[model samples]
Target chain A: NAGVTQTPKFRVLKTGQSMTLLCAQDMNHEYMYWYRQDPGMGLRLIHYSVGEGTTAKGEVPDGYNVSRLKKQNFLLGLESAAPSQTSVYFCASSYPGSQGKETQYFGPGTRLLVL
Target chain B: AQSVAQPEDQVNVAEGNPLTVKCTYSVSGNPYLFWYVQYPNRGLQFLLKYITGDNLVKGSYGFEAEFNKSQTSFHLKKPSALVSDSALYFCAVRDSSTPGYSSASKIIFGSGTRLSIRP
Candidate 1:
């Protein structure tokens, strides 16, 4: 299985431009997450989906939106990209469990640069 | 609130020397600890985790971690360092008080520690 994969591995956008980052998983996980990695600031949660058709705000949800239209896909949208938002974005998936399935599987990551 | 800390900003070691990366955490309930490695221009990869039962947790790449409940620390360790092991390491924790199905089962991560091994 591919586990989890993210599309558009690299992208550049103007301050007002908008774009979407797509995350897909083959593991049939019930939970998905979007996180941004910045220098000296570990991964910060942006948004998350508990299951298909359900999404929630995370620690840093500003300037972004998320939709989980399909069980295997989770999409993160940048309404208006900003230089401050330029960071490596990572998507992860996992089964909602207490014993063994909580180990999150991460994607290769998508590098974004906003000017 | 639950949090994780990696006090060392960077750690350096010789190829054959033993290596240690320190990590500490605080949680309201039982903690599910994890260690992840990130190479340059790559995403974080799961190395190991400490859920329960064992005080010493073994993981991928011949690495291991010792969970010290009294100290609230889970330090990653290796018997011998390899130059190829140079990378960034992150420590994370999830508070077990939150139900597994809740969206608030957030995993908090440390800022990260850079490990460099010289041949």
Candidate 2:
């Protein structure tokens, strides 16, 4: 199994450009999340989906949108890319319950640059 | 609100010596704690977690974490430091009652701690 896979491993976009980062997981997890990693800031949640066809806002959802139309796919979109939006994006999923039971599994990550 | 704190920005250890990366959390009610490690240019990898049962939790790569409920802390530890272990570590937490933890809560991560192993 491919665990989790993120597409567009690297991309560069100009300000106001639009793009979408795709994340697919074979784990059949009910939860999926998008996070951005900035220097010195660790990882901050951008958006999440609790199940197929459901999505919700996260801590840093200002410039992003998400969709989970399929059970295995979660997509994060940048409608208008800004320099501040340039960072490494990660996708994670987990099975909730027990301690250590919900350890989130992360994707390889997608690096985006906005100039 | 649930949050986590990694007090040290960086930790240095001599190869073969024990290593520790401190973490503390703030949340009402029971807390689910987790530790993750990130290597250069890669995604964060699960190191360990503390949900319940024993206070000491063993995880991948010979790493473990001690959950001290009284202290609101979950510290990651290893018997020996390896140069290959040098990387960024993060602590995360979520209140057990949080909806996100059930079907809606997203994990909140700490700023991160950079660990270095010196030969």
Model 1 spans > 4 angstroms off:
A99-101, B103-105
lDDT of 1 at A94: 84
- Compose the digit string of candidate 2's lDDT tens values, residues B1-119: 67789999999999999999999998877888889999998889988877789999999999999999889999999999899999999998877775534434546899999999999
Any residue pairs clashing in model 2, and if so which?
A99-B51, B100-B104, B100-B105
Off by over 4 Å in 2: A97-101, B100-103
Candidate 2 on A1-115: residue-level lDDT in tens?
9998999899999999999999999999888999999878889988888789988888889989999999999999999999998899999987644423477889999999999
Predicted candidate 1 versus true structure: per-residue lDDT over A1-115, tens digit per residue: 9888999999999999999999999999888999999989999999998899999988999999999999999999998889999999999988876533277889999999999
Error of 1 at B38 (Å): 0.9
Taking the tens digit of each residue's C-alpha lDDT, what string does model 1 give over B1-119?
Answer: 88999999999999999999999999998888999999987778999999889899999999999999999999999999999999999999988776645524478989999999999
Among incorrect, acceptable, medium and high, the docking class of model 1 is medium
Q: TM-score for model 2?
A: 0.95
Each candidate's chain A: what TM-score? 0.96, 0.95
Give lDDT for model 2.
0.88
Q: What value does DockQ give for candidate 2?
A: 0.56
